[model samples]
Target: MIGQTFNQNRPLSQSLDTQGLKTKTRSFWVPLSIFFVITALSITVLGPQTQSIFDTREHIVQLQQDNRVLVDKKNKLTSIDKSLLTRQARIAVSAIPVESSGLAALATVRNKAFSSNITINQLRVSEGESSEKDAAKEVRLQFEISGSLSDLLKFIDSLSKAAPLLRIASVKMVGDGVTISTDLEMKTFWAELPVSLPPLNTPLNQVNKKDQDLLGQMNNLKAESLGFVAPASASARENPFAPY
Candidate 1:
């Protein structure tokens, strides 16, 4: 029975083989069509949009450059702040004496001026004579400094940035180089000044100064801020006695 079945299917196989070639078709057309469609959509939609962005290439480059410059400036400013904070930490800020006026900050300035290879021959200072009764009062001062040109410029620049607000009103330069002389009149400010102490009926310093409250406060301020350590909180450190 198996031999007869094999013999019968032989002709059928031969016939199918001859007809199969006629029905055979390639399968690449569907994928090829999809590829064309995708390419067309990208060129018509996404391609033009991307090309527009390229048109602004010059502007984008300039903006990037500007941003980099600004970042550099920011870094420089940050470095300056850190340097100032470090210096302030090393040297405590003392309250200037209210009476002598400009004695504290001015001394610091004058010392710096002298050390900066500058010779200061003449120095003058005048504390303001405003009444302690005045609400808006400042302990004004006048200074005339003679020094080398470079050293004087550096001194002026430092004082401007330093705390307590040292200001220069006038500067006169006489010569150049090693023989240079710069005369500067400078001023520092104090918001309130203490009143001049008067003759007391009782022993001195016993009675409270009711009238010259600002003056007394100014004296205390000078004492406290004159190279005194800031409180722990101001120092950005934890106070040991602070409540837990």
Candidate 2:
């Protein structure tokens, strides 16, 4: 009877121990699973917002850098002499005019020919060809002139240094010992200025040594007319369409 009572008590104790272990395991696993679920939810909800905040910070830094560059450019521009800039602008425009018409080029040619003692018998102006849309537009000028061989040679040489830049495309000459008749085809170029400026954030490039040298070379170009013209010699035109 005593042995059976001891055996029954041992089995009851073992059953209690198993129940306690199960309760402890349930408590541990329940909290662990809940922690994992909360972590997943937090990543899903806050990941995009965190990334957006980081991107915004990077953009702000980039804008700050751009602003600094623009301010530097503005300061440089403000410090420059306005008169000097104006003079340079004039020089540049005279070198390559804005009008596609060959009026400036024609004037230069006439002035040079007169100075060289060459007589222009015939002159014609026409448009030139361009391969690119935004390329410089060209104006073609054809000339028939007669002069002494020496004078004709001097006129051609002077054309190289004249402003409203001219390029002699083809030249043909027939001489009779004392006088020479020449046929000349020349080209002049013009381009339109951009109507709009770049964005405010764009960095302005300072004129470097190469650009300064180019400007100096253009400054050396011979202007078409340096002497004064008498304004009183002007004649009024009533009808340009009327035939002579």
Residue 189 error for model 1, in Å?
Answer: 1.3
TM-score of 2: 0.75
lDDT of each: 0.58, 0.87
Candidate 2: residue 195 Cα off by (Å)? 0.9
Say which candidate scores most in lDDT: 2
Q: Least accurate stretch of 10 residues (summed lDDT) in model 1?
A: 199-208
Off by over 4 Å in 2: 1-25, 33-37, 225-244
Number of colliding residue pairs in model 1:
8
Per-residue lDDT, model 2, residue 27, is 75
